[model samples]
Target: MAPPAGYVNVRRDVTDQFYRYRMPILLTKIEGKGNGIKTVIPNMADVSRALNRPSSYPTKFFGCELGAQATFNDDTERYIVNGAHEANRLRDLLDSFIDKFVLCASCKNPETELIITKDEFIIRDCKACGQRSNVDMRHKLTTFIVKNPPKSKKAGKGRKAVAGADSIAGQPGGGKVEGEDDESDDELTKKIEAGAAQVMSEEQAQALIAQREKEDDWSIDTSKEAVAARVQSLDSKLQNSLVLEDDDEEGGGPYETFGEWVKEQREGEGVTDADIYKKAEEMGIAKKHKSLVVLVQAIFTEKIVEEIAGHVPLFGKMTTSEKHQKSLLGGIERFVGEIHPDLIPSIPKILMAFYQADILEEEVLTQWGTHVSKKYVAKDVSKKVRKASEPFIKWLAEADSDEESDDE
Candidate 1:
């Protein structure tokens, strides 16, 4: 009876229904290439929330009913099946899942909680009617529901405990000695030890020294400390295949100087968000789009959500190109990673802010989500950021689908 975007009353056949409770329509996206091709159900989480069940239940049911492999990528919240399927067909199939697992047998109400006893019995505990009904345990989803049980209130409190531990674990100083704060010192010591080991192979080491001596003509420092430093630098250069350069004398490296510039601008007046980029361009910082990402991280403080929302116009202007969109994603990854890794939970809100601002389009985000990269953050941080962004990414896909439907 209402617009179908946010919440819609399910199915047309329920003529007697007067309830205001509603559920989102099923939205699916086809993604990947060749053998990697799959149908991604983006709104499974919201639908499952409406049905009072784990998101995986209906996803697995779709796979079983469709006779295809369903994989729940928990990281991306992209519940994908191994084949392409139509949205209407999947939506109809979801009604079946609701009938079976969601609705209580006695009261026929969706206000039900799944209960599993030590005897491995699957029971639906209805809060509305106080009726307990045993669900048929024959379905494959029962085993999954048992293993991946619903998170109880007690578990919700325990999440705080986990968060506390993660805060300590996420820091670079997580595994450091109590009093040792200098990471550079530890790094230098390790490099020296590694260089000493490289000097062990008599023939190879002699050959390298001979070559260096011939090239330097003994004009360079030949002392033991100097030789060891030279060996370490050579090994570092060979490993990276590049030399590390200092910040530009003009304005300094983008990251090294941008934070101060941002602080100065934030304290000043009449500087619109786009003007920041223009200023960056004047300093040659915007020449590299990746530098924009670094500048983004430098610009924000702990209140990243508020900062991003306030600066939406700036992001919208910069994110016109695919490269800039990808860089914005990378910048978000870095900002959350170093500033407040605990803010990983706020990824969905951040993404929604960008989406509402028209900074990140669904197509660009979907393309970026299909791959995993550590170009901007560490592998672990990358994984956490990706996992945190799952819900928002899924919502974007559904929103895009709804727009397409309205267009058609």
Candidate 2:
């Protein structure tokens, strides 16, 4: 059967696959008192899921293009742009977003993922053609994308190895083995000495030696005696180069020391969750700020998922800003997505608890819910987290509708 007139196939070109992938047409309803009026996208979540994007991306795009503020209230599933807009106009504007953010540049297919590089450039990775096209950074959406990159397709080590091989094959004298010819020690020593002359410093020589050792691993003798002798020789050279440290500390720097301190704190009995956050601040974890999210992940275990309601105050104290909120969300993603995927069913309950405690606002949750980042977790884990949270997300949206009708 044909999809409703208000709905369209995500891959518009694939008319035959209508039933396979369909999304409702953009819908808008303007509501509020004077000066507070806003257009609400009632089905924004459904539309976003169909396009495989965060609902906030398109909602934000609408606001940016129209020069207005946008708000996505997860509690109510109310996607609001701070102005009156026609449903048809939004539907048309959505096509522009799909063209820029959704469609693959090469195949024009909608099967694409959003990738944000470390340098803050956005890339549209097409699943169909396997082409990665850089998105124009001039758009306002780029900043949001950097903060909330979509889940990427898992490219295992095999793909990376194949790519590395391809690059190597493209280089000069690419595939041929180096130093294959039998050369006498005297001649090889002369060549090594000549190469060493090009080495500018002791650091460079150390690096070179490390590289040579790595390359020689397979060819080197693995017999127990030979291995032991090689290890002893290397250990002797390393000891000669080593600088002694004070007895007060071990070999590592401040970060490692801080990590050890945190571990010690975690091991202490009768310690509360609040005590952990307080200790983190005292140890300047709060000052680092960047490390707070990582600490959140490490601090919370799978056991917390079963009792998230009690930990609300801890999360509330920890998330002092948006970055902290993002980090906390990232931590949750890792804990549930990777470590204990079986606890996926508990996500909605945890989120509601966070919401009720005022630890996370609706806007924050809505924005966080849309993204699947590998920043705090593994790629596969991020994917699993998102998959597991879908039902809870849908329920959250409908729960909003139910509350609205009751108010009416």
Q: For all candidates, what are the clash counts?
A: 0, 0
Q: Rate the local accuracy (lDDT) of all candidates.
A: 0.58, 0.56
RMSD of each: 23.2, 20.1
Stretches of model 1 off by over 4 angstroms after superposition: 1-255, 264-275, 402-408
Residue 375's lDDT in candidate 2: 67
lDDT assessment of candidate 1? 0.58
Cα lDDT tens digits for candidate 2, 242-347: 2122352433233233333343445554345535554555545544434543454445556765555555545544566777766566656655665567777777
What TM-score would you give candidate 2 relative to the actual structure? 0.39
Name the Cα RMSD for model 1. 23.2
